[model samples]
Target: MTTTTRTIPAIADQIVLVTGGARGLGRAITEAFLREGARVVIDYVTSADAAAEIVAAHPGRAVAVRGDVRDRAQVEALFAAGREAFGAPVTTVVNNALADFSFNGDARAKADEIDFPAFAGQFASAVQGALHTVQAALPGFDEAGSGRVINVGTNLFQYPVVPYHDYTAAKAALLSLTRTFSADLGPRGVTVNMVSGGLLRTTDASAATPDAVFDAIAAGTPLLSVTTPAEFADAILFFASPWSRAITGQNLVVDGGLVKD
Candidate 1:
């Protein structure tokens, strides 16, 4: 059977929204979209200063709005702020907000030490946060007649080398949502997908990781270097670009060949 899809707007014409866009990988994703001439709406729970800096740097192209993605009302307000900024609703969304987490393995609770509450906390942000954003963006997506939803994920689900029990489990659930959402929304002119990255060389989240851990990950990768937030951001742009119009429900791993899928 053949499937039909709507024509996605060019990046220049798209108004983009990035959750947690003030720092780390989210910042890079926001910048990448802006560089492609897309008007960007940056969502931040904290990091107001960083968000302001980005807005100042980009001038008219970017605006930062504060919101907690886990709260459905806040998420809807976040989109409303975006609509007010650019005179149009967001046509593309990157669900990149993460609950507070640090990548230092030594500090992480061991699987046995971690509890259900830990898992629940992560799910509240990663899974539910994404759900809220998608639901909030639906009306906008319907208005535009085309949309792109790219959920940030992790390579750990495939390899589970470090087994960050709570964090990894939450991301695993997010990947499932990415596919299911794609199926339900594809015909309606929305494409949902995921971009999973390995241990990024450096980000506020990974700063706590020791240098040795970074070195080891680099050595293991075919590229002989750990991926950077900027590198991963490029792949995120692909899913939102015109090139990815017909592709959905798939996860593209962007970890420099660390995990083959």
Candidate 2:
């Protein structure tokens, strides 16, 4: 066997802020950025203590700010705090903030439990959060002449096996926004993309999932295994790197071939 190493340039000097980086998938995304030598900032709503723990581990390499993505003022404050901590003009941002998605009681949700208002709440956090972050960072991106925004998405929109009407609808709108933003920002050297993956086990977001549900998904997928958060982070790093310089307005799925579309 031959030894091989990734050649991606060190982004140690670059600052990357991840929304909801206290634990689970968001934490993994944040760590991936740190591993790439990038100064990392994490934003969270209720995970401040957890965020503090991450900061303690990384020292100056990581900073965590408290804020709720659903609230515009909180979002603004979060970015402002991050700017003061890590300097102005953030270069890379990964919109991985999402409302808790652990299954409440069933593999599928009843329409009555989550209505239109609930759906709106989901969109407010996912799509609007991306919109707010992109808007807040665009001036910086324009001044710098280059930047990257990677939105975290789900694969539920492909087939809609379960009625995650709220979550799935919000993500679908997010997917549309990712593409539209890419077209609008492409001319400015700002790349926008979405990384959608299947139900990932070994994460808090999927913790409440039933065992039968896990087996169902694992057996249906071509890989016959659950996708790990760290593995999904690899795909995120790709879109954020120079290797994907020419790639944008695309949804890269890492769902183990569960759905071809």
Candidate 3:
């Protein structure tokens, strides 16, 4: 079978805000937007050096800002900083910031060991963070007459191969918010969607994952290879471009066919 890829036009005119964009998948997403000619604000809490490096590499195209997405006040400041730097309100927001946690499935807490606070923290970062960003960006969206929100998610919510209960649960809730937000913002010309990825081969969060796990996951996938941060980041651009104007309230899994859904 022959498959052709469609090129998405550069979103140079749009100012983008990416939470947790200093490192890991977030960094990749930030760079991807920059390469597409978009001005990007890299929001980070502790990865200041890494964020600075990204800004230095991209020069005028990217700026790094420190903010905690779980805090509404900080989220507002994040948007404000983006506008001040780029002289325009952020037209696109990617909720890619995750709660500080490693992806070592073997060390993860099982159902019995997990508690309410665990779930609460995850929800705070996954759901509340998105909420704060979307709320902060509403005015801008209203001004622009359109907006795009791409929520970063995971395939574990579907396959649960590692049973990362808290992480997966939080991501599932994020997916729910993505759809609900689409419904509420659709009439306003705003679109909300999710890009779910499986166990990425390597990232700060996934660095602790054993090599055996990666091999197993790759063997199960039809592509016989793990997905890269760059590949997953590319899928996120689709939702922010004109090509996806008609698409919303949907989840696109980019795990190299590890999970069919």
Clashes per model (N, Cα, C within 3 A): 0, 1, 0
Q: Per-residue alpha-carbon lDDT of model 1 for 1-261, expressed as tens digits? A: 877657789889999999999999999999999898999999998899999999999999999999999999999998998899899999999999999999978889996788999999999999999999999999999999889999999999999878799999999999999999999998889999999999997899999989998898888889999999999999998999989987999999999898987
Q: Which candidate comes out best when scored by TM-score?
A: 1
Rank by lDDT (best first): 1, 3, 2
Where does model 1 exceed 4 Å of error? 1-5
lDDT of 3 by residue, 1-261 (tens): 854333333487889999999999999999999998999999999999999999999888898989999999999999889888988889999999998899987788988888989989999999999999999999998877788999999999889898888888999999999999999998788889999999887899999999998999999999999999999999998889988988999999999999997
| lDDT (C-alpha) at residue 72 in model 1 | 92
Quote model 3's TM-score.
0.95
Ranking by TM-score: 1, 3, 2
* Candidate 3 Cα outliers beyond 4 Å, as residue runs: 1-10
TM-score of 2: 0.91
TM-score of each: 0.97, 0.91, 0.95
Give me the overall lDDT of model 3: 0.91
Candidate 2 stretches with Cα past 4 Å from truth are 1-10, 104-108
**Model 1, poorest ten-residue lDDT window?**
1-10
